[model samples]
Target: MTATGTGTTSTLHADAVRTLTDWRPADQDQEQLRLDYLAHLAEQPEGVYRSCLPAHLTASAAVIDPAAGRVLLTLHPKVGMWLQMGGHCEPGDADLASAALREAVEESGIPDLTLLRENGAPVPAKLDRHQVRCTGKDRPENTHLDVQYIALAPAGAQALISEESLDLRWFDFDRLPELTDHSVRDLVARARRLTA
Candidate 1:
């Protein structure tokens, strides 16, 4: 596996391109989004970073505790929604999966999380495109082209809330809070299937 958050912007950019190129989409919509992400990276070489405009690539992960039959979610302060842990591709992020794992660790405060892999590789389980004021409330809304992954956390793991989140909690697979949107629900379902 590629080391997380240990490369330069140029290297991270290249890895992003290669990752999207090699990723297999589960459906036509995801395929199109994959193509669109590739196009964005081509046009804007720095699209993997948060500084990119209009749209940028972001990495996220759903933290699943299969033994406990639950998933960890954060109540985002900015979006005011219960969602997975993720953010911009930082300079230290060696690859998309590493970035996702880093975000998962930081957001969930779980030190021993491992990514759910396919064919022994940490690949994305889903892709989502959404608009957000990621920069700040004063800044214009930008599109987040998110690459989502599933991470496995140790059972009975204790979590600590970070500044980015309003609250953090675990929810049963079938009993997610109403604050979560369809996208999050979809991610949870996908994570569940991956673990099961």
Candidate 2:
């Protein structure tokens, strides 16, 4: 599980490689993306870290209020888009699931959000690879190979906006804002099926 070049090791990076290697993709497209992620990890020891040039692995969660048939989204300041809650894996993160959950809770400010589980552990509901300007306004774009999950918000849960977001709001599953892209919608659809 040690990355070849870095000499230094990261448990998060090792966990990511193991998790993706063990995951069973639902379709051919997912299968292809899974392989691509493994390849990235194989070549770059820092692939799970944001500092990895060009591309890196990110963990995210779609916060779903299943009782209300709503999904909580953040108005990302950088992209100016309504998107899921997540970010780069941190050093403290024990695994991809923990990273995704930490991002979800921190971004949403909803303390009790719980990840939907599979086999008694939080598993990714979907995977998305997208271009982003994560470093700064002046920096070139990077690719985020996002491992997406679903989190269930407690009844009457209220979200506070973090500095990372311009705003935070919950929208009906059928009425997500126009600012969102197909990736968000697709993630929501997969979350919906998981919750159902």
Candidate 3:
């Protein structure tokens, strides 16, 4: 498994190129996004690391408890939606999966989460490209090329709301919030299937 947030991009392009080469996106849209991310990486070199520009790479996680009966979600402060835990990539992240796991642990406050794997490789189930709200002077509105992963949360794992989130809660797989968007629902379904 890739170590947690220990590999920084050698020249701003190395990390993104390396991680994308290893990732296997699950659908057509995802495949196209991967190519777009690669193009972005090639063009900007720093695209994989920045979050405040026109387009930047981001990582996120869909966390499921052991039985897959529940999913951990956060009321995102910027989006105001009960969504999966994730955010911009950090320089310390070893790979995309590591970045997702790091965000999961931080946002969900679950200390013992692990990435869901198949055939001994990290399983990246989906990709999301969405517009982000401009919430800070340095964080102007932009699109995030979000790499999504599924993670397993140990039984009885507790959640703590970080300053970035308004609240944190676990929703039964069958009962998500009204405002949870369609893409997130798809992510939940995919996570359930992949982790099952």
Candidate 4:
């Protein structure tokens, strides 16, 4: 499907728009957010793929261990907060789910993390809208419309800190770090239901 937005003509982005437009969110709030994202993408071609604008699409994973008792988190260097591992979508990404999985694997250094999906597309466990500082000076401040998913880590999957992270650790659901944000907990709750 060709996109009717104002941005570069990329079929990859058209696919992303189509995927988001077709997804069924779990609740009314999510439904609204999904529709908003779809509309934004339909109007702004770069809206679905750009990381430098005021509002952009991002994908993240709440990395759940195989036993589902612990979640892997990364201390964001720029934000100075403990958060889930995720980042902006890239051109090579086939879809948003693949983008989320790619970010999870890259940041976790875990080779075999498994993403949850429905009907062959990555199904987000939850959606979050939050403001983020542009980590790079070239990009302006932006709002991240994040597609959050639950990724199952292989047993004994060890997390290593990448250049983007100050630390990486697994926390029990009941005892996340003191610096972890409230949204992390919400992501966990949604993820638990998905994994259960």
* Candidates 1 and 3, the one with greater lDDT: 1
lDDT of 4 by residue, 1-196 (tens): 3333334645656766777777787689889988888777777767756553788888899898847488999999888888998998887776777889999999999989889878775677878888877556565578888888888898778887788889899998888888977789889877777777
Question: Which of the numbered candidates is closest to the native, going by highest lDDT?
Answer: 2
Best by TM-score: 2
- Model 3 whole-model lDDT (C-alpha atoms): 0.79
How does each model score on TM-score?
0.93, 0.94, 0.87, 0.88
Error of 1 at 167 (Å): 0.7
- What tens-digit string does per-residue lDDT give for candidate 1 at 19-128? 89999988999899999999998888677888878899999999999999899999998888999999988877778899999999999999999999878888888899
lDDT of each: 0.89, 0.90, 0.79, 0.80
- As a whole number from 0 to 100, the lDDT of residue 19 in candidate 4 is 72
Q: Give the residue spans of candidate 2 off by over 4 A.
A: 1-7
Residue 1 shift from truth in candidate 3, angstroms: 22
Model 3 over residues 1-196: C-alpha lDDT tens digits?
2223233333334656776777777688888988888887777655666543788888899988857489999998767889998887776676678888999999888888999887787767788898876446465578888888888998877888888889899999889999799889999999877656
Question: Which runs in model 4 stand beyond 4 Å of their true positions?
Answer: 1-8, 135-140
> Where is model 3 poorest over a 10-residue stretch in terms of lDDT?
1-10
Write out the backbone clash pairs for model 1. Answer: 5-92, 5-93, 5-94, 6-92
Q: Model 2, residue 33: displacement in angstroms?
A: 0.6
